[model samples]
Target: MSEPHAGSCRCGLISAEASRAPFWTSYCHCRDCRKQTGAPVMAFVGFRDEDLTWHGEPRSWRAGGVERRFCGYCGSQIGYSDDRLPGEIYLALGFMDEPERYPPALHAFEARRLPFLHIADDLPRYSGFSVER
Candidate 1:
């Protein structure tokens, strides 16, 4: 049996646990994600609703009509839930322990990727997200 995956906010106020490994992982370069995360690119792990649980109330806000949650005290991003991907929550990979274990398999919104950042990898780059997810 595998152990549940875990993550916590910088201030340790918000914590999360997933009963199973993520089904999808990717890097997003959309403007909304950039602005919200204060990064050129953002990595996320997609977990099913039934497999994930939260331990604290994370502060939430909407941008581009999508809901994102984060720790209010430390501003550590927790994740986002998109209506387009119903029953899935995309959590910020940076907050997870040993994040190297959940490497992103592809890049999303590649057209919007900032010029200053370069992720030289052969991973399939998508102008948008993969349809299968």
Candidate 2:
């Protein structure tokens, strides 16, 4: 088996590893993401929920229909789970040990995207949500 990609929270109370590389990387520009991240966009990596293992139990909160998890000590946003996307997990890119390794392949919620943030990269951009190529 290949080496897993490891990550941890700021306080070291929460850590995680993925058996495989991320299935997808994306930048979300929705209002909810911006408010949560306190940034113009929020970066995330998608993987099978079962593929991710945590070293410690994380604190969870419900936002809409999703369960957002974070380190209770450091308040680092770690990841999230949603019943709408069974068998999959969404990890906050900021929590990655090597965040630069995961470049966003797509931009979502562009309709509500902040006007001050300019993304010059050539990755595909979408107005809202999308589930297909």
By how many angstroms RMSD does model 2 differ from the true structure?
1.7
Error of 2 at 52 (Å): 1.1
- Residue pairs of candidate 2 with colliding backbone atoms: none
Report model 2's TM-score to 2 decimal places: 0.93
Lowest-lDDT window of 10 residues in candidate 2? Answer: 124-133
Query: How does each model score on TM-score?
Result: 0.92, 0.93
Regions more than 4 Å wrong, model 1:
131-133
For model 1, what is the error of residue 33's alpha carbon versus the real structure, in angstroms, after optimal superposition?
0.6
**Candidate 1 backbone collisions, by pair:** none
- TM-score, cand. 1: 0.92
Model 1 residue 52 CA deviation in Å: 1.1
lDDT string for model 1 (90-109, tens) is 89998787688899999999
